[model samples]
Target chain A: MPIDRDDARRVAHLARIRVDEEDLPALASEFNAILGFIEQLREVDVRDVEPMTSVTPMRLKRREDRIAGGGIAEKVLANAPDAREGYFVVPKVVE
Target chain B: MDGLNSLSISEARDRLRVGEITSMELTQACLAAVEEAAALNAVVHPTPDLAHEQAKAADARLAAGQAPAMCGIPVGIKDLFCTEGVPSQAASGILAGFKPAYESTVTSRLFEAGAVMTGKLNMDEFAMGSSTETSVYGNTVNPWKSGDTELTPGGSSGGSAAAVAADLCLGATGTDTGGSIRQPAAFTGITGVKPTYGRVSRWGIIAFASSLDQAGPMTKSVRDAAIMLEAMSGHDPKDSTSADIPVPNFEGILTGEVRGKTVGIPKEYRMEGMPEAIDELWASGRSMLEDAGATLVDISLPHTKVALPAYYVVAPAEASSNLARYDGVRYGHRATLAQGDDITAMYERTRAEGFGDEVKRRVMIGTYVLSAGFYDAYYNHARKVRALIKKDFEDVFAEGVDAILTPATPSAAFPLGQKFDDPVQMYLNDVFTVTVNLAGLPGISVPAGLDPDGLPLGLQLIGKPWEEGELLDFALAIEDRAGFVAKPKRWW
Candidate 1:
């Protein structure tokens, strides 16, 4: 399966990464190359095989629904690029 | 160059226990060596103040007659492991100047064991590339040289391998998703162990491909790897994938006795056009194990050829999801917006400026594969193939095969820029090692011999799940037989 320039541009959008129009051709070609490599998996007979949910045989561990630990809002927001009044600031979305 | 910093972990431990040397002295020696070897670009963030503080604490522990094997030993922490108040950038511009508020579980354990932290070593950005060339800090040059050309230390654990090989640090931490640890170890003539999945806690290590990512040790020798790995392994409640199993005394079980053990030679790994030197090295490893009273049996892993392709799919898909937290709203780099750009534009521009070319390529591919109408065709299909790849190992192990032996890498270290432009060629470097990760089994790379160019090559040993003790024991056997004491001439 080959991806065209339009598909590449759409993928960059879906990934929330900006890809210029001029670079879409090169990106599409790179996608084609990788897709060509992975296309070999189509040949494997996976009729009755189950997709692996976990590598180990163990089930997901259950835990009590209690607060583990959280109170230092300053510590949690320490790395935030823009924090005001102990809240992360992002661009206005509902305008 | 024969200094305290060059001493192996076991050697340093013995010296520290007998009061022959202080942790402060060892830490100073390593700090000076890290300064001298600045050309290698191995230690990206040298934490001298923290190192001195840790050394003082370790010396106190040693004097109190309470010391573990790692007490007073100076080791490099790969930048992927977040250290509180220390820069833990995974060699990425996106994470430029990012410091975690808390300590990673692995580093915390090492510190609790009284291990001295020399510094944070370099790695591929987000552990993405095979060459460390993708590092925002720049390429970490391999201490080994081929002619006048500077070779890669082999990534994304390239800095870890280079630091250990160059004796800048006694041992260093490394994480292997797809041969990040083993490949670099082979390239630098050291020992690297990728313990069975769930063996080491991944609580604070920056995520790449969660299912496949595993933290291990890269050291000068197999015994040193054993000592370092035991200190690093255990269960953590923070990481649910962490196994709740007892970490065996890895160093104690390394008796170098493999009598009557059966080693499997996977027929599928003998890829066509493999460098003759690598093939010869594999043969020597086989004979060495046989000489140690182990029986050699030829086996077939029919899905070996698909491991690499499947890995590229699975790893990137997970990476695409794991890396989604790097939005402009929170930590790390946020692109300065243009006059009228909206929130979506903010995300697009920030990510565009943040990620490198290879990272962008992977993210795009991952998004394309996981998109509507293509999910079953690519992502789920790859998962089924991954199951088959895992079963291939299960079938072999069930038939009394104690371990499998193969070339650690397709070849020895190449010049830094040789395959930088060709992503496919670079991906081929992990051909022989990805099968172990896909199967979630323990695997190790022990420096076996040198190529015709006098570059070091490693032989890999694959073991049953959660059997790292046995794996390390077999690796010790190979290490003793090979006697791989050759070191690169120090030019750095």
Candidate 2:
């Protein structure tokens, strides 16, 4: 389906990426082109085929749920744009 | 022989053992080369002090006769691989000042094997674009060129390819997600291998599409690729998907013998509008493999046409989910917020300002596909088709095809900005390469021959899963038969 300007706006919002009002049409057209190209996938008969999540046939490796490797708070917050008293400081949502 | 930086990894290892050349000398030579080729914009972070320190350590190990094969070798680490305390931006604006406190598994393994790091190389933003033009550092120029037109080093591993081709480093690490490594290697006239999906650990490499991303080596020769790959690969407990298989001695077992191996030539890859040079190169590749006592069989990967579209859907869908972690809170470039702005506004502004156009397009597409209304039709359907694509490879390999041979790319390196305007045109660059990623198989692009414009073209050899040893051996055969010794003219 061809994506409209509203659809592009919705997608950008859903993606949490702010697209300018001017760029929405361009984004919509690009999405439409990609969706149009991807429409070709409907031609293949995928009846009874299982969706492949990974190339290998292995379950997610599980281990004992314990704190295995996270002690250095300084290292963890080394690249943080905003940190306060060894904790990441984000905008206050509850306020 | 020509210079310490020009020697292949194996040759450097030999010289290091025989006391002919020290690791410090080789690392210094590569550092000098990196300085001389600054115009190429290959090495993004030239860690001279760290490299010299590692080289000295390697020399000490070699003196004690305890050095591994990669001991003292100077290799360029792709920026995708996070080096502890070094900036590991996936060449994106959002990751502008982000530095990881932990090292990636692959680079850590390379470091453990005594490989000296020259610096982090440039790549496409989040390893998305094929031209490396989307990088914040700017487009890495292909060392090869026509009269005066500068060409692009195919990306997102463009910097890796350029550095190796220009002799800036002995070898460099590259991550292949939908032909990032192979296409760049072909463009720069070097050898690159994309190991099977689970071959290399992806612990610290910035995630692009977790299922499609695999790290490999870009080198001057297949033998060098083998040595580098061996050092870079092994199962890591951290990466749950990393294959728990024994790492084979890839360089030692390269006898260049492909006798009794059935090489498959897929009819589906013979796409229309393919340049005559690529076709000729493919034909010659078939002949060369046949001459190596391998039987060439016509095979069919019937679902090949849908691979690209499916890959686009799947890769972006996963990328959207993976990149969600890059919000303003934890790390990376956080957008300055206005008064009374909440977390959601911060996320929107941060992502809007951080990601490039191509990345935004992908994330939007990914979100659209995974949205409530279109999830089953787009993302789920694409995943099912991806299974069929994998089945197509499985069927051919089940029929005893040891490896599949095809053209690595549709054409040689194009001039920069020629295809930048059209994203579809740029996406076509990975047409011949994306199928391997979809099927989760190992693929290598070896410099086959030159095109009419005197640019290098590459032939791809796709191997069965977890069979990179055989894949590299067959690539060595092609490298031997093709005898591709041409290097890009030192324009930089």
Candidate 3:
């Protein structure tokens, strides 16, 4: 399917990226070109073929469901843009 | 350039063993070379202090009669692999100034084996682009320049290729999602191997497409690749997907004997409108293998044409999911928000200001494909197609085909601005190498010959899953016969 400007805007929003209104056409065109290339997959016969979830055949490795690590809250908060009292500070979410 | 800096890992290791050279001297030579070649922009974050400390420790280890194969060798760590307190930006503005508290498993293993880190190397932002032009540090110049025209060292492992080819470092770490290591290695006249899926631990490497991403070595020769890959491979418990298989002594098994080995040349790789030089290179590569006593056969892999399309869908889909962690709150770059901006606006603005054009385009594509209305059509269908591509390789391997040989890239290194504007045309550079990534097979790019312009061209050898040692043996056979010793004259 061809992605229109509106679709590009919506995709940018979905990806949490802000796309300027004027650049939407260029973004949409790029998306269309990529999609047009991949659209050739429509001809690939995939009947009875399972979607490859993992490249290697291995089960999800499970460990004990407990707190195995952590306690270094300082290190965790080291690279945060804004932090106070061992918590990341973000813009106000709740009024 | 006539110093220890030009020595390969095997040569340097032998010298270190006999006490003919110290790791400190070798590292200093490389550091001096790196300083002189700043025009290449290959080393993004030069850790001279760390390199000296590591070299001192390595020299002590060498003197104490404790030596690993990689002991006292200076290698470049790709920016994608997080080294403790060092910039591990993945060459993306989104990760600007970000440094992890821990080292990546591969780097840690290399360090444990006494491999000294020269610095963090440049790469495409998020390992997304074919050329290193998408890098935050700008594109790494290919050492092999065709006349005065500057060429790209194909990426996202471009810096690793450049550093190895230019003798700035003996060997460098590289990551391959879709031909990142192999393509750059091919363009720069070096050796690169993308090991079988789960063969090398991916822990602490910045995720691009988790299922498709792999770490490998970019070096001067296949022997160096084997030695470095042995140090880089292991089962890391931290990485759940890391295989529990035993690590083999890859360098010890180099017989260079391909006698009676059945090598297949897939007919699908002979694409329409292929450059004549690449075709001639492929033919000459077959002769080299034949002369080395390997039997060649023509094979069919019908799904080859669709592999590129399937890769675009799956890789972008995974990239979108993997990159979601780069919010404005936790780490890396955060946009300067105006007053009254909400949390959602913070996320949108930070991502917009941080990511490059190519990264945003990929993220947009990924979001569209995985969106609710199109998930089944684009994402799931591509996964199913990926299954078919993997099966194509499996069938060929089952038919007694030990390995497959093909051109590493369609053409030699192009000028910097040649294919950057067209994404589709740029993606085609990986046509011959992507299938190996899709099928989770080990693939190596060995420098085979030079194009008419005197630029290097490499031939790729694809091997069975977890059979990297065997693959290296075959590559050694080609390396012995091809004798590709031409190096780009120093211009930097």
Candidate 4:
């Protein structure tokens, strides 16, 4: 199915990317092209085929649910765009 | 003696051990070559002082009678691999000015093996594009050219391939999520191998698609690839997916003997509209292996045609989720927020301003597929198709096919800006390569021959999972018989 401009805007919003109103047409067209190509997968008979997530047959290695590492707040926050008082400073979430 | 920059890792290792050359001399030669080839736009960040210091340390180790295989060798670390305090962007503006306090596991392992880091090399932004055009540092030109018609070094590991082909470094680290390593190696006429999915640790390398991403080596020759891969691979407790199996001595196991090996040529790969030169190169590659005492057989992978579609769906889906961590809050680039803007607005603006066109396109596709209404049709179906694709390879291997051979790329390096307009056309560059990634198998692209246009053409060899040693042995046979020693002349 060809994605429309509204669909492109919704996807951009869902992905947390702000798409300008003017660019939605171009974005919609690009999405349509890619999805049109991807539509070919529907033709394959995937009856009873288990979806493969990990290529190898190994379970996720689990460990004790205990905190083993941390406490270097400065190093952790080194790359943050805005960090103050050992925490990331983001725009106010509360009204 | 020829310049140290031009020597292979194995050759340089031998030279360093025999005291014929010091690591400092080799490092200087490479540094000079990097300076001379500045027009290539290959090395994004040159770490000359770190390289010199590492070289001195390597020399001291050699003096004390301790020499690892990679001792004193200067290699380029792709920009994706984080080096402590070095700006490790995946060639994306979103990662602008983000320097990691910790080094990636692969680079640290290479350093442990006494390798010197020459610099951070360029790559496709977030390892996304097939050509280096997506790189924020600018496109890395292919060292091989067709008479002044500048070409792309295929990415997302384009800089690693270009540097190795141009001899700026002995070998460079490369990551192959889809065709990043193999395609660029083919375009630049070098050797690159993407080892089994968990063979190399993905601990510190920025995640694109966690399931498909793998790190490997881009080098001048097959032997160099083997040596470097041995150093770059090992199980890390830090990476849960890293295999618990012991690392093999890949270089030592190179018997160059594919005798009695049954090499399969998948009938499906003979796609319609394939270039005549690619067909010729594939036939000649088969004969070379046959002459080296391996038997060739015809096989079928019926799902081959659908692998690309499945990959586009799965890769983008995964990328969307992985990239969600890059909001304005934690790290990397953030957009200026006007007063009264909320957190959600900040996130949207930061991501919108930070990501490039291609990345945004992928993120959009990803979110569309995974959205509430369409997840089952696109994302779930693509995962099942991926299973079928993997089973196709497994059935062939179970039938005693030692490896599968095919053209590394549909064609050699095309002129830059040729395929940028159409995304599907650019995606087709990974047609011959995406299956290996989908199946999580080891695949190597060996420089097999030159096309009639005097550009390099490569032959890909896909091996059983975690069997890179055997794959490299087959590649060595092809490399030896093909006798492809042509190098691009110094035009840059």
Candidate 5:
């Protein structure tokens, strides 16, 4: 579970955040600190406690399963740096 | 003066109804103010032509005898929201060039109500910092202090708060995940409200912990808060989480009488190393309620200690999942690699270069908490603690307490980089405000008074999920009695 410079480098690659080699040490250190914090939770007694997904303690409201969405597609896509064919245009992934 | 920049939403509506101040004039005044405050660095992108074009249409509607409550009001949309045609980045490199073809429902609703968006205000990238310092664009400085270089307006909705506080815009939209809206409002000494989650649709607002993300209005007055909330709240078919309750007259219900309300003064909020002025200001705020015929009741939110840690766990965990879409292929800045580069390498290179250290720190924390070996230990347990925190509020509310009051932040806005060194300490700035978010309740931060350093101290009010009416009434009553008038000198 320990994250070294290599692991941090991999994470940086995954997250699309550009971190230089010099910065990888700091990122690794930060990752270790976070892992250390997570380790502290190991001491808590939570065997019987139920995981809470929401605070309201209410059942999820049920709606009839149906496709109903409203909003202009042009208005939605207006912020995209590149858009074509009514979808976000990205570099060709498949040759 | 164009009514849009200076007039309250109600006044603006009245003018629109009677044809007094034209929407175009109002929109122009806001554009002019944005130009004047360019040095404030409040607005990241100004869409003056778009705003004016919208304003012209609104004016035509009014001239044709159409009456919209928000007709002609120029507002600032925090850059976190995606505005079609305008760039929508979460103020981070990963989302740098990513634009949503869709408008966030909240801002679009505001536009539908005739509020012209003047520009996109700056925010901490992905709403991830207390000081707005995490913004890739740049850190936002407070408008309250005149000529002080390092004074922060607060974050990650710092620019939204600054624009409203500096009178650059009539009202600005803010999204609160963990104290983003109210903390910035407090720092700027403005009136900002974070409605109960789902009260406003999050359909178009960029996600920041889906459960906690909410779009609210930051205005200069409580009345404006009401009018704006009415315009902002509604059931959006796009946002499945959007509430279906009918929006209330937030303005009309301001009877300003807190006669029978039992306000809770939680003891746990008073911690060690707390300042004397904060106690004095809190006491003064309480006394104001007592004078207004409300009883000050002592309450115990016993699990208050766990709110911050739980929030740190839950928010970041969700953030890790929510932010995963920003790989190089779909949207945002793509770090360069050779042709036929593996997809995984592209993601790694792009994310590593795209996010800043604080953001990286958060993503790391988020990933760690949700990772295979730690999910049950970290995220699951924190969620249980979250339940306890919610129970504390429920028990107190069941005991006849209408609202709870606490200092919005542990301290007034600290030096620019004061808490940056210690990330945990920086996260603790959200301690007082996070519980409300955890409880899925409504809370607001009103400027209470000044600390010893003359920085603004804000008092937070926690209310029942749907009882903002009672809460705002109580806040206004206290605001009246406290006579806390510390306006920003930069404005004058």
Candidate 6:
């Protein structure tokens, strides 16, 4: 559970945020503070607490689940920076 | 047209129905006011031509004796909702040029009801942050408070709140996952309501947290909120989670019939640093309700202390998953690496350059909580706390309390960037407001009075499921007695 420089860097990289070398220390500190606060929750004894998913105790409504094929290919592709042929085109993955 | 800008939604609708004024004049007034307040940065996207076309159609319908429920009112669609041609971004760098192909059920329903879309108002990135300062588009200044100082129009929905408060638009659509609508409304001295979870459709709302997010009305008056909510609510086949319950005639429910109604005053909402002025004002609000023939009861929502923590976990976890679509290949502001580019690098680079610091911080926390080793420890535990918080409300409601009263926020609103360095303090902004979102219940923030610093404070009202009409009715009664001016005096 320790957040060293490498862990912070890897996390920053995974999150796609550019944390400069100096900023890494600050980000790490913040992460630690958040973790410290979260750790406090461990002290609470909720042995019998049921995991509540919503405020109202109503169950999730079910319907005949089916797919619409997104119904709007061009619409989905519209926001794609380099979209083509009713699809989002990205650089090839492997050689 | 009789100062259409000053009229409530009910008045406007009645006038339109009786042929007192055409839809064209009203829509034009809204558009003109938006133009006049261009300096407030309240509008992110404007479609004057489309709005004029829609208004003409509305007028034509009136001439032909066939008008939809909300005839010809110009409403500012919060940019968070996906409109057909109008671009929708959750006000983040990640989805700069994104436009949704499908319309959100709420937006589509309003359009169906004969409301004109003025344009998309600005918001905080992914509905994060209290001040709209986090938006990629610059901060939304409080349109009511005119000056070069650029005060904090409390946010995530600051733009919509500001627009409505300044009469840029008669009303605006606001989405509150956690305090997005109410906080901003309180700051701008307008009435903002966050309806029960399923009361409105979340389909195509550009998700923040799927479960907690719901859209509602931000308007100048309670009756306006009601009319707008009726038009916005209903069953949407597209959004299965949407409530199938019939939308009530919200205007029909606001008869000030709150005699003998029970309003709960939860002791937990009195946070440690809460201003004494808010404490006294809260007392005054309760007394006014009592004098109006409602019983004020002291209640305890014991689990309220845990609401902020549960909200932080649930909202971010969902946000992380939802925002994963912005990984370069899917949409918007792609960061292209030089040759030898791999897929992992592509995603990393794209997201790195796209999201702001606040978003990245959230994503990291979200990922951490939903990670393989931590899912149960963080996300599941938060769910347990979430249930407890819900139970607390249920217990109070079961004991004859019709609604809960508390301060909408810990303080009115601090200066912009006051708590930027401390994320915890920034998160604290939602201490009073987040519980409602956590519980998926209806809540509203009506401006009460100023704090010691002369900043506006809000009296929040929390209601049980599908009880928005009743809650708004009570709040509006309070407003009539409180004599709250819909527009702040200093508002430009």
Worst 10 residues of 1 chain B by lDDT: B89-98
DockQ of each: 0.85, 0.84, 0.91, 0.89, 0.38, 0.57
Q: For candidate 4, lDDT tens digit of each residue in A1-95?
A: 57788888888999999989998999898888899999999899999999997898887777788898888899989999999999999887776
Candidate 3, residues B389-417, lDDT tens digits: the string is: 99998998999999999999999998998
lDDT of 3 by residue, A11-43 (tens): 999999999999999988988999999999999
Q: What is the TM-score of each candidate against the true structure?
A: 0.99, 0.99, 0.99, 0.99, 0.92, 0.95
TM-score of chain B of 5: 0.96
Task: Report the lDDT tens digits of candidate 1 across residue range B381-471.
Answer: 8999999999999999999999999999999999999999989899999998898888899999999999999999999999999988888
Per residue, candidate 5 scores C-alpha lDDT tens digits across B1-492 of 333576666667787788777888877877887887876788988899899899888888788776567777889999999887788887887787666776788888888988898999988889998888888888877877634646778899999998887777889999899999999998888878888877888887778799888888898777788889888998876777777889898888887699988999999999898878888888988888889999998999987777777788898888888888767655677778778766666777777778777877777777767777778778888888877778789899998899998888877777777777777777778878888888889998888788877778889999988898888998888778767767676542
Q: Residue-wise lDDT of candidate 4 within B38-157, one digit each (tens)?
A: 999999999999999999999999888778999999999999998999889999999999999898999999999999999999999999999999988899999989988999999999
Best by DockQ: 3
Of 1 and 5, the candidate ranking higher by DockQ:
1
lDDT of 3 at B381: 97
Of the true interface contacts, what fraction does each candidate have? 0.82, 0.91, 0.97, 0.95, 0.38, 0.55
Off by over 4 Å in 1: none
Q: Give the range where candidate 3 chain B is weakest over 10 consecutive residues by summed lDDT.
A: B360-369
Model 5 has how many clashing residue pairs?
29
Per-residue lDDT tens digits for candidate 6, residues B1-492, read 435755667778888988998888888888888787777788988989989999998988877876765878888998899887777878888788887777788888898888988899988888888888888898887754433455778888999998888877889999898899999998888889999988898888888889898899999888888889999999887776787788888888788668989999988887777778878878878987887889988899887777777777888888888888778887778886889877777888888888888888888877778877789998898888887778788888998899888888777766766776788887778888998988888999988776665567688999988988889878886787777764555445
Model 1: DockQ against the native? Answer: 0.85
Candidate 2 vs 3: which has more DockQ: 3
lDDT score of residue B416 within candidate 4: 95
Clashes (N, CA, C under 3 Å) per candidate: 0, 0, 0, 0, 29, 2
Candidate 4 Cα errors over 4 Å, as ranges: A64-66
